[model samples]
Target: MPVELKTPPSDDWVPSMDDLPFHRLGGEEEVKALANAFYDAMDADEPALARLHELDAQGRVNAGTRERFGLFLIGWLGGPQHYMERHGHPRLRMRHGHLPVDTGMRDAWLRCMRKALDARGISGGLRRFLDERFANVADFLRNTEG
Candidate 1:
């Protein structure tokens, strides 16, 4: 069975986003790579999920969508706040509210992200932290019943 995505308890202390090995993971380039890989994985394997994003003539995620996601990932991973400065706060739920984000869609997203992180060779404690955190967000984004 697939692991479920849920937030961890607040009682335990966890590193802030900026303290999550962003520099150790090679900062901007690596984070951007993760974002690209994420979209690539979704495009290649998660058709249902990919359909929700803006695509180009070739049926690939558009440059603007990819670029925006990359910037969001960069800031989310604690590298830089360029995404915020350029686009304002990431109103994640508000931004995604237009879509019917059911459990299956959420799972598909997590699968793509897992593939991206694995492709990037993200492991150890960092991997665990990322896995848990990503799950939390993915779960939170679900807006429909399965």
Candidate 2:
């Protein structure tokens, strides 16, 4: 199960987006869990986005892609440098260069991620922060205009 998020107390103690997200997310395990949930949501709700990904024999997210993404998210959310340590700098656009990622694809990807974040009950400041960040990255990934 994904970790449950609770609102911080009245006293202001918001960690920087760099630190808070990973810590609030309960580290790698929760991130991995979110990754799994994210893909599961994609497979079930976003057929177009799911089709863009390579799936396994059972039509689930391929193990390698999931794990790599889990690691990527860790580094992205300020958890660890696992993805960079293992795969070096993440040339995200180049890595996804083969795919024709347009605005529609970007929006679909964001929609699936939004579903995953909501499904995990992620809310409050953490959720808002992530929604903004993910939106930016998703938009940036668009390789074609329109």
Candidate 3:
């Protein structure tokens, strides 16, 4: 005789992994760590981050850049919308409009992001998704020669 398979009970179907909640509160810690890693990579990889460092030196991304980037990442990583709450809409492209973000710059940014993500020990799927999303955002931020 074949046994019948029983269906599991269905509840409200709450999502198991709530990305937003995960990034809120202490979630900002990861963002801060990622920012640190990104900066570290920029400092270490001379050629990759040369242009970015130049821009930073020009005061385009002064000291406040770290704090702002941390806050922004907090929100971007599905944490509390602190960046949006404090700065209103991100207006990413507009904010970066003055910067000369070329293909090389974009690649450098992605490289730093990749290193940071790798350092985070995030799940493979999440890492892949984030990398792709970051690439798209980085590409959108690019406003210079190809």
The best candidate by TM-score is 2
Best by lDDT: 1
- lDDT string for model 1 (1-146, tens) is 99999985343435664455566467888888888999999999998788888899999888899889989988887778999999999999999999999998999999999999999997766777788989999999999999
TM-score of 3: 0.72
lDDT of 3 by residue, 77-114 (tens): 67778888888988999988888899978888888778
**In model 3, what lDDT does residue 62 have?**
45
As a TM-score, model 1 comes out at 0.85
Model 2 lDDT per residue over 1-146, tens place = 99999976433335676556888889999999888888988889887788777889988778888899999999898888999999999999999889888888888888889888988888877788788999999888888878
Candidate 1 lDDT for residue 31: 85
Whole-structure CA lDDT of model 1:
0.86
How far residue 38's Cα lies from its native spot in candidate 1, in Å, is 0.4
User: Which ranges of candidate 1 are over 4 A from the true structure?
Assistant: 1-19
Which scores better on TM-score, 1 or 2? 2
Clashes of each: 0, 0, 0
Candidate 1: minimum summed lDDT over ten consecutive residues — where? 9-18
